[model samples]
Target: MSTEPTASGHEAASPAVDPPAWLQRIKSNYCRVCGSPLKLLKPDGEREWRHVCGSCGYVDYHNPKLVVGCIVEHEGKILLCRRAIEPCRGLWTLPAGFMELNESTAAGAARETWEEANAAVKVLAPYAHWDIPVIGQAYILFRAALAPPYTFSSGSESLEVALFAPESIPFDQLAFSSVSITLRLYLEDLRAGTFRLHHGVIDKRPGSQPNDPGAFVVRDHMALELGGASATAAGPGVQEQ
Candidate 1:
């Protein structure tokens, strides 16, 4: 199919038929310690194959990344950012980013909100943990609220920033499945007057390529629809959020 830019000034969403190279965790092809070519080998007593340097016996285990984000609320509206970057530019998403060194996950979430939405939020609690094995990313989200005056604007990574009422959420335009899952459950809880920790997995459909339709299967734990982790599961040390 032909492609065109959307009203948001980003390219139309296209099927990721070809495996999205950006999603895959890069495995080392060579050993950094000995500068030797590495081979994928299963160690005698291990359950997984890793890049091993035959010369020095050094091994590199490729690990998934930790992504931190928040569900920020102001009044009865939820905050969202329209991404101005790749992977899913023009798509709407909650403010989030990769966890950085020396920062608690909750702190990371707060930083991301400030960086992407220019809003200071007080993170309240752990919300959900979802593992996207297909993309080698584990998302940890928190519940948060606008700090003080609750002012916000678009950050460098976003084209636009706005608060969305539950019924006005652009579900079809969300950048990631994790965002969809979190928002869906958040809305359900909003109506039900109860909230709890949620755990889920985003699995790749068997025999499907990245760009194939229905390539990923999202599991939702609650009555309606939708959906990994580590780092301060929140409290006093989370003072920054």
Candidate 2:
């Protein structure tokens, strides 16, 4: 497996196909809502094990986390941030982060763009959606254009921020497979002059064969029907219709 130096300057291994053993152990042993030990139980009509709290009978259901990001375009170049944090530090990626409470996905995408790249953008159409079951994450990516002034700086989460032409994007140094795939699809659509919504699954769980050194396996790719009206621009940190 290929490895890269993280922000701490320690060589980190590629993303695992399976959740780390520690995570599984932690999930199996406790209930977050109630201070109680948990036991595995299969509810009626369910085949999977669920953590059940013996004290409050609370079923701890683990769901995928929502991650939002944007492909911000300016003067025919795309924005990317060099991560200052771990997981894939020093590598480049689209401005993205986990969703927070009381915010729409598009709002979260725009916020992350500003937070990571210090660049304001007019959030546009949904560019991509991905389900990564193994890591328990769903990524919502949007196509956005740089708002007036077109200025940017690196935020605390980034070591540097810069723009690169589509042909100059460093695919090999991308922080995540989702970012790489999104950029590739965006560039392809840009050439075709038709940006459509892309939906897919990335299963990196064990027993699966990864297409690349990183355990990411992209599957179930297809264009989706845009069901709603076109997206509109909204003010910074505001949700769009």
Candidate 3:
């Protein structure tokens, strides 16, 4: 969906909308394991419909993919790539892509940076993670620095690659929601001279169409969200210890 570049902070409203392209469902006709036509079934004790094979009993799971990326800082600038492919072609974004098999998240992040930016990086730590339920993707980004003899060029998937200072970042022309959120938060931390893990959700705005980029809401920390409890809370299974 078409939208103006969102500002630097949390949006006011976040309404869950139907996922584009039916992301929550598997559209493939054949099972990956046995090449048999798949059937949608809940299976015994399963809650969600899964594509399962009656012949091989192979269950096709539609798990959310991990899109790993890096916020590589060199000479106080962050690396970005200009896409040469569709789905936001010609837009600038962090060096990221889908994680590959048999690799750790950090390794995948590093690999993506190299593949798209032609830059070798040393990952420092986990920096941010954002869940986009609308597209069934969870972004795992990292803090990194350019490795020895820092140099870069555009890869096959990128039309160009470059570094941008915080003030010079192309906020309005970022390719994806995840990239914008990562860069904005990174810049905030840079100004504060402190770094910490960030987590958030990107959900559809109320009344938004399928083509809209949706809205972002800060979720703070997952442990804080799931662990905090009320002192006076009472429920069907409540018992004071």
Q: lDDT of each structure?
A: 0.76, 0.78, 0.73
lDDT of 3: 0.73
| Model 3, runs deviating above 4 Å | 1-25, 205-241
Comparing 1 and 2 by lDDT, which wins? 2
Give lDDT: candidate 2, residue 217: 68
> How many clashes in each candidate?
4, 0, 2
Arranged by lDDT with the best first, the candidates are 2, 1, 3
Once all C-alphas are superposed, what RMSD does model 2 give against the true structure? 10.1
- The TM-scores of all predictions, comma-separated, are 0.76, 0.78, 0.77
Ten consecutive residues with minimal summed lDDT in candidate 1? 227-236
RMSD of 3: 12.1
Error of 3 at 236 (Å): 49
lDDT of 1 by residue, 3-118 (tens): 35575444333233432343224557778998988876567876445678989999886779999998887777889999999878899999999999999999999999999999
Largest TM-score belongs to which candidate?
2
TM-score for candidate 2: 0.78
| Better candidate by TM-score, 1 or 2 | 2
